[model samples]
Target: MHDTGDAETTVILDNGGHNIKLGVVGAEGPRLIPNSIVKAKHEKKRVFVGHEQADCSEKFSLFYVRPIERGYVVNWDTQEQIWEKSFSKFDIEPTTSRIAYTDNNYLIPALPDVSNEIFFDKFGFQEVHKASASGFVADHAYKIRRERCACVVDSGFSWTTIACFVDGVLIQESVIRIDVGGKALTNKLKDWISYRQLNVSEETHVINECKEDVCFVAMDFEKSMIEAKKRFDENMIEKRYIMPDFQTSFRGQVKGIREPLASDAPSIVLGVERFAIPEILFNPSDIDIDQCGVAEAVVESITQSPEDLRAALSENIIVIGGSSCFPGYRDRLLQDVRSMLPAEFDVKVSENVANPETHAWQCAEKLLEYPAQVAWINRKEWDERGDSLEYSRFFRTTVTSDELKATTQEFEQKGEKSPKNGEEEEF
Candidate 1:
């Protein structure tokens, strides 16, 4: 704790592709801010950065200038602006405070160089640590359950990743990334709603709100499909989502199918889509995405790890990230994962019931509590170790882009050998 910096002064920034969790280490909770500059259709000339978009009106649609793409910071300028505002909450000058943040598992090789340029040169931060999101989940698991081996299924905004951790250390070779996540789910919901009821293709923010409000993973996809096809009076899964008009309402809300509605009010009727939208995460091929689902990826990651840790990994599986917040996510994931594993092996899947995005930040705080684990690079080390500086000293750095391409191809090849008819009996 002493080596990292003062807990009261240290800043925790869990910079996810969709939302950035920011707060001082001692704060009760982190401020979840959108990680994109928003362009409100009503205010074309004015762009809202981070949480400022909450004030503007999305009359037609809202466009975003996202700093991070595919989980890596691609535009540092946009990121710096968001960071500038987020850091301003703690101090005008972060030159003295330490920072801890999370990144994607399979990161861009050169992303760290540009990130360091921003950390040291642009912002003048004293010390910083970049760890994979799942690594912190592993850290938390080790501390709470004392489970040395665990598999982390992190389905975030951009990518859904499954990685194995043995003794709180990530086995880099066991990391598997899926192309489906919150963004993909949102897009699918948008497409479905556009095709079925309303044209909400341009209404990304509104559609995302609609998705979160009503979407839930179906435990039995076939059963849910049966319910979805039933009459409105007999269908229990049918929901009526009232779209926001921005007068008295802010965002959309899910209402019961029998609920009252005005004649002129705009609304979308959600049927099987409530479960089908989230189905992509379990079976990406449901929407033509070649990647395997979360449960399959989790099994693949654990099986590839050392044989001794596979059982332990199965027993202590943790799913963290935005997509994991869905209502039936845990139950559905546990069912699928258990089905794939041997009947004798114990299987359990869990997520932060309160908030999935903040799990990593909480773990980061706990990780910093033990001084022995603080591997921050201060200005002195950044200056002295010009050529010898190793980014992997703090966390595992992913392979280069070319190597990453090869790994993706390998994933596609392995995806062909999916679990016992994962999505074979689709609706």
Candidate 2:
């Protein structure tokens, strides 16, 4: 790792569809700013960003827009607006030096295999380092806890990526990506509500509200679903959510009403809303995939390591990302891992130390604290490394299964790991 100098402020951007988390990275940790690009419809015109937009959601018919779809920037224009609004919050000029870190999802478009010397030119970031979401999660966890080996199950809004680490560095081949995420779960809720109510617009609002207030992971899916299907009263179902104004005011509170949208619209109950989230981790098949569950994915990722490293890997299972913030998520993850793993394996999840979403950015700040290390990265270095080596070879995996298996075995035997993987892990 290289550093450039005394970074007055390090900007870490953990962009999620649900929330775009930003914070200053320093000696302390990532200072989370609870704001994002999804502005309230009324505030849409103004260059609003960060936590400020969150307060204004109710004022202007808050029309939330996410430029990122499944971890990549699907709409750069909207994303540019989001970044502009976020940067304006600092009250700093456009000339400020910044270190920008983003998830590996960048490989999708903006930072794809194509060599764009203009990336630095366009974004004001003096130093930019992009790693996969799981890689970033593991990197930051290693910094805070000093755990050498672990599996990072990053269940974020758009996608869930699992990454493995050895001695603090990510093993590229051990990375796994799944199509399932909080968005899918939210959409599923949307579908479920639509089936019962027949109104997409109103149902979308309810689904979003339910996701914010009631959604959580279920440690025991079969048992919990049976319980969730039981009847419950409105008093027991009501949840107080602090509503934000999208125009002028900052905050307010409103109880979620499963009230019938129209005279004919079916009323939504809280039990079903809360029950849908955790099901994703256990049943990707619910969304039509025959793949393994998150815990199973973690176990499979760790199995790539040497037998001696299994305990170390299991002990540092750091859960970071937007989806991890759902209520009871950590407990459910830990419980699921415990149920499936050997009795002796130790599995741990990250706490709300630096905000679950920004932990990776905090880790990047620690890495860029030294100016000397920072200056080492230049376009020249990238040019020297070449596209095939710097981007293609690392980001794109087109190898055969037999070759992939051989490589995985080779890494295991060598006690080495990289945050690179084949078809099973395509984050």
The root-mean-square deviation over C-alpha atoms between each candidate and the true structure, in angstroms, is 7.9, 7.1
Candidate 1 — which pairs collide? Answer: 1-371
Q: Say which candidate scores most in TM-score.
A: 1
Tens-place lDDT per residue, model 1, 1-427, is 3265442367777889999888876667688888999887778889888878667865458887998777677888899899887677545367877777675523444445466667778888878776777887786666554565668888899888888875566776678889888998999888888998899999998888888999999999999999899986898999999989888787787788998886556998999899999988999999998888888998898887655556667877877899898998989889998999988778877534356767777777766655446677777777787425545466653332233344335445665221111221100
lDDT of 2 by residue, 241-349 (tens): 3333323424333345543332332244445456565577667887677888887777777775555566667766777777677777778777777777777776665
**Cα-based lDDT at residue 118, candidate 1:** 78
Q: Please tell me which predicted candidate would have the highest lDDT against the true structure.
A: 1
Give the Å shift of residue 323 in candidate 1: 0.6
Instruction: Flag regions of model 2 displaced more than 4 Å.
Output: 1-9, 27-65, 92-96, 106-119, 198-206, 229-267, 350-354, 371-376, 379-427
